[model samples]
Target: MAAAVLAGAAGSAYVVTVVDRPKPVVVSHVAEVLDGETIEVRDGDRVTRFKLVNVDAPAASECLHQESAVKLAELLPEGTPITVVRDGPFVAVSTQDGTLVNAALIAAGLAVPSVNGTMFLDRAKEAHHSAAEQRKGLHSPDIPCTLPGQVRAITEAAAAVEAQPLKGTKTELTVAADTAKTAIGLVDQLAKPGGLTWDAVAPVDQTVLLAKVTKVVPTLYRKEAELRNVVKGLR
Candidate 1:
C-alpha cells in the first residue's frame, strides 16, 4: 500500500489511497498549453503530453482553431492543478475545482464530441447541442466555419439506410439494395435544380455547402458498397 498526500489548508492533511503497483498514474500539474485539446503536464521530474478526451477540436489551420485554443488556455493556464484519467491513448482532464475541461470545450462550441469517446460521451454530445442552440463560439452564425446543415442531411440519409434490413434478416438482398438506392437518392435531392452554383448561395454559406460535398460523398459511397455486396451475395 502507498499513501499519497494532497495539498490542503495549512493545518489540514488529506491522505489519498493508492495501491502499490509496478507503475502508478499520478495527477500532474499543467505545464504548457499545446492546443485546444492537448497539453503537457508535469509530475515531479517527469513530463508527459496528453490529449483531452471526449472532444475533437479543429486543426490549427482550420477555422475557429485559434479561438478554441485561446478558450482552453484561458480555462487552464500553466501551473493550474488538474487530475487526469486515462482513456485509451488519451486522457480526460478535470480542474481541481471539479470543472471538466472536455465538457467545457464542447459546451462553449470550441470542440465537438469525439466519435470514439468513451466516458461522458453522451454528455459531451448534449453539451454540443446546447452550444449550438446558444450560438456560442464556433457555432455562431458569423464564425465562418462549415455549418452542420449538410451534415444533418447526410445523417438523415444514413439513418434511412440503417432503418432498412441491411444486416441479417429474412429480407431479400434485393430489398437491401433498394434501401441503399433510397439513401443515395436522398443525397441527389440535396442538389438544387440550378446545379448548386457558387454564386447562387450567400458568400458565408458557400464554404459550408461546398465543403460538405466531400463529407457526404463518402457516406453515399459506403452505401453503394453495401449495395454491391448485397448483389454479390445473392449469387
Candidate 2:
C-alpha cells in the first residue's frame, strides 16, 4: 500500500474521486472522445471532463496515440449513448460487457492510471498496482516509458530513481524528471477523453468506483483546434 501511494504521488498512479450523484441520469448529453481514455460530455452545452478507467492510451506524439484513438472508435462508436453514472468525483460509464474495462486498458497497455485513488478510491490504486505488476510492460511514472515487452519497466524505473541524487547533479535530475513526467503525462493523456464503451454504466458490484455509463452523444473528440496547434509545437 505504501509503495502504491508513493507510485501515485510520483504520477505513477491516477487519483479519482467518486461522484455520489444518487439520482440516475442526473446529467445528460452527447460526449466527445479526446483520446483513448478521455471524453468530453456535453450536458446542456456544458462540457464535462471524464476519465476512462482501466485503459491507458499514448499521448498526441506517442507512437500509438492516434492508433489507440482509432482502435477505441472501432471498439466504441460515437453516437452510442451509454449509461453514465457518477463514480466519486468522476463521471463513469459501463462497458459493453460491464467488466470495468477502463482499468483494463492499463492492463492491455492502451492507457495509464490518471490519478491516485483517494480514501474513497484507494481500491483503484491497488487495482492499478496489481494490474501493473501483472503486465510487466507499459511503464508508469513509477518507472520510465517502456514497452509491455520489457516486463521490467517498474523495477527499472525504481532503480533509476534510487540511483539519482535528489540534491546533487542537476543534469541527472533533469533527465530523471523528464522521464518520469513523460510517463505520467502519457497516463493522463489516455485517461481523459475516456468513457464507457458508449454502452452503459451500470451496477458493477455496486462499487463506488465502478459506476456504469448510461448514454452519450457519439463524436470523435480531438483537442480544441487551437490547442491542437500547440501540440504541433511539441512535435
Best by lDDT: 1
List candidate 1 stretches off by more than 4 Å.
Answer: 1-26, 146-235
Q: What is the lDDT of residue 101 in candidate 2?
A: 33
What C-alpha lDDT do the candidate models reach, one value each?
A: 0.62, 0.42
Off by over 4 Å in 2: 1-21, 24-31, 42-49, 53-57, 87-89, 116-123, 126-235
For residues 82-191, what per-residue lDDT tens digits would candidate 1 score against the true structure? 77766567766767665667777777877877766564566567667777677676566454333444345555556565555555543554565565566465556555
Local distance difference test, candidate 2: 0.42
- The numbered model that scores best in TM-score is 1
Tell me how far the alpha carbon of residue 82 in candidate 2 is from the true structure, in angstroms, after superposition. 1.7
Candidate 1: pairs in clash: none
Worst 10 residues of 2 by lDDT: 212-221
lDDT of 2 by residue, 1-235 (tens): 2121112322233333224435334335336677777776666768777765434457675544665676555444565444455445554453433323354444444555555333323444454456455543333222333332111332344345445555544455556655544433433443443332201111232122221111000100111222233334542
